[model samples]
Target chain A: MKKQIITEGKIYFPLSETLKLVIENIMKRLTRALLTMSGIVLSIAFYTTLMLTASALKYTLGAQQVISEYYWWMLFLAFLVSATGITNSVLMAVAERVREIGTLKCLGAMDKHILEMFILENAFIGAIGGVVGFIVGIIAAIVLNASTIGISSFFAIPGIEFLKALLSSILISTVLSVVMSSYPAYRAAKLQPAEALRSVA
Target chain B: MGGEASYAYTVEVEGLKKYYKMGNTIVKALDGINMKIYRGEYLSIMGPSGSGKTTLFNMIGGLDRPTAGKVFIDEVDIAQLDAYELAWLRARKIGYIFQTFNLIPVMTAYENVVLPMIFAGVEAEERRRRALELLDRVGLLKFKDHKPYELSGGQQQRVAIARALANNPAIVLADEPTGNLDLETGMEIIKLLKELNEEREVTIITATHDIKMLAVSDRIAWLRDGKIQRIEKRSEVRFKVYKVEG
Candidate 1:
């Protein structure tokens, strides 16, 4: 009455399910999204604040040290916060998935499979949140620039430097998310299915 | 047993012991328990609170390492496998149904059922097919796009059952599956489980305080204070099963 067990083929193969589950988590993350993303918001705000301060200094004092300050430094700080936010969200999600993780383990999911699921989900989260955040960041920067420098500042939209900046931000966010989330992903993967199910909040 | 044409049992739990530390005190959840469940067995593990039904289930599922003893499934000792090996085994070999339903509140019913197969790396077309099939099997295909909040408790548990069987594991270990449901809904769940066992030959191990489940079980292992106080045969031993009114 039942199918025979022959497990030579992949049981935990389609990476999309994990991605799908994570995306669902990300969507549900909205209520607490602000809280989860506080680190990101603060980092972005800090970098922008510093940039505004430096720009003010450059205009008023025209110091050589101010001239030497690169915009990349500001972007780096923003990227760090963004990466940390993604990593934090991912780790928290894994921690919440204790029973589900245990269920997966009990159902014969491999550790690598579980690990792959979390990493894939986190990476997807990074992609969705990072890209959206990058777009939002760029828009904010442009709007501020426009208000400060007048309509002429709108020309910066199609500039080659603008495209490059966007690309770099996305790249940085992706790298930051992946690198930061690896350890937590590994922890989720190494969890024992049976023991994990017994865990209570 | 090498080159043998048959597996010894669906599950072989032998002298398995597990201890938990509650602050400074070590609580023995299971103290050297042993069991053998053959293929197609409709068994209920009945126990009072603090009994080791869950712990025993955990060890067999490879979610916990025992303080002592071995658990074999399809001739493989689950306790012997390392973490990665055990994970792989679980993904392919077991179907677990929990009393809590436990579906992610945000995802649709389709997504919930597909979680197991998705983890198993089934291809896109096949995964979709299987998810749909499973949803239909649980009579939730029409509710595929709906989230968990939209469903009733019984519906959610049905979805959980579908998810558990997603990988089509040899055994289904259900813990208090009807504990949260009303009498009518609980009876419905029990009927559905019975159908699954009969039609699929999926060995069912239900842990519950539900008297109906014990009444209809092939065997009922009554547990008290972390020990199997009595094991009774309801009808034909080890899965011949007792008939009950639908």
Candidate 2:
């Protein structure tokens, strides 16, 4: 007999099964996953380092009045490049696993389930990459601004400001990762299992 | 079961047609076909490469939509169901075994078998128990922890069979189950499938080119040019052995 439970008007998979599948798939290709996530890590690290350097320069050069539109444009450019990198990596992942997706579908996975798998996989990558990037960025920021702020002064930034910066950087990276992977995840979800099987062979 | 309209057959197809557009010309993969698969019977569909055997199997398994037809699995017309409904049908009623032994490469044999149960949302403890039992049934219990690459082709196919039975599906659709195995291993797989048919009364529909599969089936249907050419009962099908010299 078939059993079903609905919560908040949506079908739910058992948490244990979902976690197992996600972890197994990710671990299966650890090297590739790490390579893909490196793109996000590098991009976020670059953006964070640049922003921190600018902040230190603003204080050292007494340029508080020099806040300008070009700063925002540069930030925009950094974010755009990161998004493109994430999209490329995610789309390549989808292409590589067409057969795997088809196999899941044949085992009774719905489009929503497939989409959830992809999104959750990338979200994990984002979380990890973001935290790693923030850690590296902090170190880079300190090293680059040591001459201007002095090593001791660099460590004296207000606790709240540092916390705020850390949280913002991680949040932005995670959000960008999700948004960039959305289209590719949707494409993976929309694949026909039969066609996907035939596509690979 | 009491409220639903019932039929003696596990699967029924009426006026099935599948056409593919290839440049200017349309290829008729399955054209104006009709068939019924009775409950608990072993049925084999034999055909040439382009004869639409796989297409027919796809329609019955709810893996593909027919351009013009109705596929009734246990009296419910599958074509009328939405994607979610079709998924439920697949999970609850139809199991599939592919020719290439399509086990997820990274998953252990046990994990592969448990996957269908997961999709069906079976309880964790129950799923594990059933998966192990199924592995034992297919004589692959010892290989439960091995990944697909670590197993022989025959062992991989056994794992696939165990996976197919994970959800206790009413019908198992096997497309060329023995096509990739050696002669002895192919025979063993066929015997195991026959045992499943006889002991559990699980209806089996296999599409294959293997002549030995035909001998074991309760009935065999031959197809050519997208149509059923003939269907013969096991006793009526005459098998003649021939030797070829290279």
Candidate 3:
């Protein structure tokens, strides 16, 4: 048999297929996915609650100052903790799937594909967490400020400001998730197929 | 020598060596191994643990780089290819079956079979059609939607075999494929592999301790201490069955 000459072969995994895979994986591991998202959800909820509460107070009382420097520092620390949590969760997930990674590599998945899958999965988790946190934060803000600012003041809070806060929180959560998970994703991509297959994970 | 050109070799390894550094000492996993595997042949590498059977299997599959020497697949030196080209070679030419049946846990049997085709850029319609066809071929079409964990050991291995044949690869490398199954199931898997090899004319190479494989293999390479001790044609080999006296 004469051998065919080598030529560049195309690797085509459509974005839709990748997204479907990511969603299926997240759904199948719903417990772990929820656990991993908890940190981001709490942190973003705290952030949105603080921001919305400060805005409502300023709008109702005409106060020159609302949010304190201490609260800002607290928010920063919360974000740092959540980011670390995301990294730890993703790394553990990668470790648990070492054999799967090896099999994917054997099936012709490039490093870029693995990295893309991880990032996309985490990013989707972050987005969902962000939205859920925002809703929780809104409700909490309204209840916490009702006695001081009254229910009427809650309605008076500018809609644009609320929208901005919601969007920012989502952006922060998504960006944080991607940035934190990048290292774990890179490690996964760099795994040697032979060694990974040998590992009992 | 005059008829050398008549023989089509799918894989050739020359002076292959793999070494690992353990503390201050060196472990020679594979030392100066050379071999040729013909097209459409059923070959088995028989050896005990730490005898470098898996190491050699990995080398041939392009899953590992040798410390020295070269591996030629279809007359092209694999060492000369870049990572992209190597991935292409693995995707287009070689299929792998593991002892553990490493199908993606999240995917169903059908999806598992379709994955390699997706990576190879096959169209969606074609992927679905071929995936169904291959699963039917492995007698797993009814269980297409079942996940790996839901299947029995033999059934899962069957799914894996379907996945391996998805891309129509020229060679299928099975590493201890029957190591985890019961005697009956192991024999069935071996027989399935033999039938596929004959039907598709795909070169089948397996590394295993299963003596049952000898009945199907055209050639057997016996490895010991990181070297091939001998190569024997199926007809040239014999086995002695002994009964234990209580």
| Best candidate, lDDT | 3
**Candidate 1, after superposition: displacement of residue A2 in Å?**
25
| Stretches > 4 Å off in candidate 3 | A1-9, B1-7, B240-246
lDDT of each: 0.70, 0.81, 0.89
DockQ sort, best first: 3, 2, 1
Mark the regions of model 2 whose C-alpha exceeds 4 Å error after superposition.
A1-12, A54-72, B1-6, B240-246
- Point out the worst 10-residue segment of candidate 1 chain A by lDDT: A150-159
| TM-score of every model versus the real structure | 0.80, 0.91, 0.95
* Model 2 chain A: worst 10 consecutive residues (lDDT sum): A2-11
What are the candidates' C-alpha RMSDs?
5.6, 3.8, 3.3
- Candidates by lDDT, descending order: 3, 2, 1
lDDT of 2 by residue, B1-246 (tens): 222324578788899999999999999999888888898899999987889988898888888889998888877777677787777777767788989888888899999998888888787899899999999999989999999999999999999999988877788999999989999999999999999888888899999988888768999988888989788899998655552100
User: What is the alpha-carbon lDDT for the whole of candidate 1?
Assistant: 0.70
Per-candidate iRMS values, in order, are 5.2, 5.9, 5.3
After the best TM-score superposition of candidate 3, give how far the Cα of residue A193 lies from its true spot, in angstroms: 0.8
Task: Give fnat of each prediction, in order.
Answer: 0.61, 0.42, 0.63
Candidate 2 is graded, for docking, as: acceptable
**Using DockQ as the measure, which candidate wins?**
3
Candidate 2 C-alpha error for residue A156, in Å: 1.8
| TM-scores (chain A) of the candidates | 0.70, 0.82, 0.93
Q: lDDT tens digits, residues A1-201, model 2?
A: 432211112223665667777787788888767876786777677666766665555555655644367756876787787788889988988998888888888888899888988888888888788888877887887887678666665544556656676777778877888888999999999998777776654
The better-scoring model by TM-score among 1 and 3 is 3
Q: lDDT tens digits, residues B1-246, model 1?
A: 123225647787788888888999999899878788877888888876678888876677666678988887777666556655555566666777887777766778888787677656667788789889888987988999998899999999999999888876778889889989999999999999998988888889998877779655888887766777768788643433363212
